[model samples]
Target: MHAFTVIRTYLRLGLLNFVQYRADFFLGVVNAAIQFAIQLLAISIVFNQTDSLKGWSRADLIVLVGVHAIVSGILGTVFSPSIGAFLESIRLGTFDFLLTKPVDAQLLASVQSVAPQSLTSLLAGIVIIVYGLQTGSGFPGFGSVVIFVGLLIAGLMMVYSFMMVLASLAFWFVKLDNIMNIFNTMFGNAGTWPITIFPGWLRVTLTFIIPIAFAVTIPAQALIGSLTLANALLTAALAVLFVAASRWFWLFAVKHYTGASA
Candidate 1:
């Protein structure tokens, strides 16, 4: 069967799976609302103490929150579900079944899982972003919006690559689930503050080492008209490098799994 046929079949199955669990779908909305409220409360507290943090006003920070929420939602909806299943398959030895399939192993593993509930968080993020722009009166022009969106797409690609790298680690160290937990911990904390608030070394780590800064901060910076040309170019370069590295790592891991002694 063609790849497109496989994708359509899986997409239908995924949608059916979510429809069967409709209650969780509604709860997703409530959870997203609460999450937004918590973020806004934190922002309010910070603004009460200081008008700005690292040159970002409260509205700017709200945009940051939106960017974080949107990216988090996408991760939860797509990357987390697929990668979690990939890890589980490895542990249970079902990964061999996936490898035997005619379809692309990565594509099969990636599209097999879907969490429809995560759309709630995505919607809430857009709401927060719109509200921020309205209050701040800093609506971006057409070119700026296009740049912001491009940065966002680049950010998502960087994150997907990062997750793939982590998932590939499962082939070597099955016990590295703990490392994934740590990644999640860091990701959760990412939404709390702008990357600029971190120390210089930490900022460098976020930007280059992990690429989380690209996922959350750069898009927010674009929205606020603060993204620098150099930084944007650097983000694009990092995204390309990550994609190449992740593909290499996935292929290497597959070779190792096939009993080729690395």
Candidate 2:
């Protein structure tokens, strides 16, 4: 309940900030629309050459695109902004204020900033997902839907954990802003496509090294009814493992930042 109140307060403040800078809202929408157009155009070009790419039809690919868009939206709206601010605060020597606060510093750092404008991508993703459902093999079964939602949540948790771990590195390296770009590049470039398209080694890298498969591919596969039980179990386990590891790492980083002993 306390966490909920704090999150609600942060969201309300974010909304007010958005209201104050309405131009950002328009720009964010325009940017998301342009990105969606580019993605759709790429999918069209790919489908023009062949009926399917690795057994995924045009509609199935669009669903994958939608899932990527939603993941991007969540990153933009929540993780990216918060982590960026946290890093900036560390560099500017303002993070001490947060450490001195009564709340959990990690939680505060992770949720203090919210970019409401990126929600446009989420809406666009939803529209694309719905369109794919209508044009594809119709709605998946209830069980598949349930599995998809569960995996989607797990995927998001994995992403948040990954970002938190990256952000925690700022305690040791304050100039690590470019490290965040690594995730952005991988997610924007490779995350939209099916993992099967890659070679066996690259598939393993994406699935375990960076875990983009859990972040986008696995959930999309669940929705499309092609997700294997083993992959699903792996994703769930990774999600839990990453979250716990991130939390522990955050505490360790904070201790180091404060000059605490082991």
Candidate 3:
């Protein structure tokens, strides 16, 4: 209850701040439009050259792209902004103030800032998904949609856990922003495409080592009604493992964190 109140308060304040910058909303919409165009064009060019990339058809690829956009929007709108602030606060020794508060530092840091502008990407993603489904297999059955939503939630949790793990590294590393750079690059380049095209080793790396598989591609599989039993089980198991590991690692990092006073 206390945590929910804090979150609600921060969210309200963030929205107030966001409304103060009306231009940002337009800019975000423009950027989302441009991104949607480029991504659609790239998919078009690929399908024009070949009817299918691996086993994924044109509509399948479009669904994948939509899932990518939705995931990207979520990361940008929520996780990335807070993680950035947490890292910066750690670097500037302002994390001391957070530790002094009664709330859990992790929760506080996770919701520290909000970027409402990135909701444009989520809207764009939804539009693309509707376009894809309508033009292809049509909307999924209720069970599939339910499963897809579950997978998407699990996938987002994994990504959040991974980002939290990375942010916690600020307790030790100096040039830590580069880690986010690598993640963004890989997500844009690799995650937007189906991971099945990659070689076996790279596929394993993306699935377990990096999380692109569970985050973007696997949920896509559910949406397209091709989610395998093995993949579904793996997604659930990995989500749990990632959350637990991230939590433990965060606690360890916080335990060892040296504040300005220390």
Candidate 4:
């Protein structure tokens, strides 16, 4: 209950901030629309060359793109913004204030900044997902829907863990903003497509090294009723492992930052 209240407070503050910049909100909406349009255009172009890419039908690919949009929206609205602020605070020596607070520093840093505007992408993603469902295989079974939601949550946790691990590097490399950029570049360029289409080695790289498959592709598979139980369990396990590891790394980085440990 206490944690919920704290999160609600942060969200309210973000809402207030968002209300103060209405124009930026509209601009963000426009930007999200344009981006989604481009993605659809690209998909059209690809389908023009072939009926289906690999084993993914057009509808399946659309769902994949929708999942990608939602993930990107969440990142932009919450994780990315807060991590950027956290990095800047570290550089400006302001992060010490967060450490002194009664709340968890990681929680505080993660939720301090929220881009409400980026939710446009989230809404667009939902619309796209619904369209895909209508045109593709119709609505999935209730069991499948449950599994899809669970996998989506697990995928989100994995992505958050990855971002947190990267952001924690700020303690050691204060000017490592570009590290996040590399992730953005990879996600923007390759995350929208199904990983199965990639070559064998590149598939392995995206799956393990960057883990985009777990973040976007696996969840899409869940929705399409193609996710194997073994792979779903593996993804869940990986999410748990990544979260634990990232938390440990964050503590270690904080200790190093505060000169408490070598």
Estimate, for each residue in 1-262, the C-alpha lDDT of model 3 and write its tens digit: 3999888887788788889997998999999999888888998999889988998989988999999999999888878898999989988889999998999988999888889899889888888888888887788889988888899989999989998998899998845899888988988889888999999999989888789989889888888887998999889998999999999999999999988666
Off by over 4 Å in 4: 259-262
Count of backbone collisions in candidate 4:
0
lDDT of 4 by residue, 212-236 (tens): 9998999899888788988899998
- Model 3: residues with Cα > 4 Å off, grouped in runs: none
Ranking by TM-score: 3, 4, 2, 1
Cα lDDT tens digits, model 1, 1-262, are: 7888886787678678889998988999998888889889999998999999999899998988888889888888877888899988888778888887988897787777878789788888888898888888568999988988898889888988888888998888875678888887898787557888999998888888788889888888888888999989988888899889989988888888843222
lDDT (CA) for every model shown?
0.85, 0.87, 0.89, 0.87
For candidate 2, the TM-score is 0.94
For lDDT, candidate 1 versus 4, the one ahead is: 4
Candidate 4 lDDT trough over 10 residues, lowest sum: 253-262
Please give the RMSD of candidate 3 to the true structure.
1.2
Q: Kindly report the root-mean-square deviation of model 2 from the true structure over all alpha carbons.
A: 2.2
Screening candidate 3 with a backbone cut-off below 3 angstroms (N, C-alpha, C), the clashing residue pairs are none
In model 1, which regions exceed 4 Å deviation?
1-8, 258-262
* Winning model by lDDT: 3
The true-versus-predicted C-alpha distance at residue 157 of model 3, in Å, is 0.6
Per-residue lDDT, model 4, residue 254, is: 86
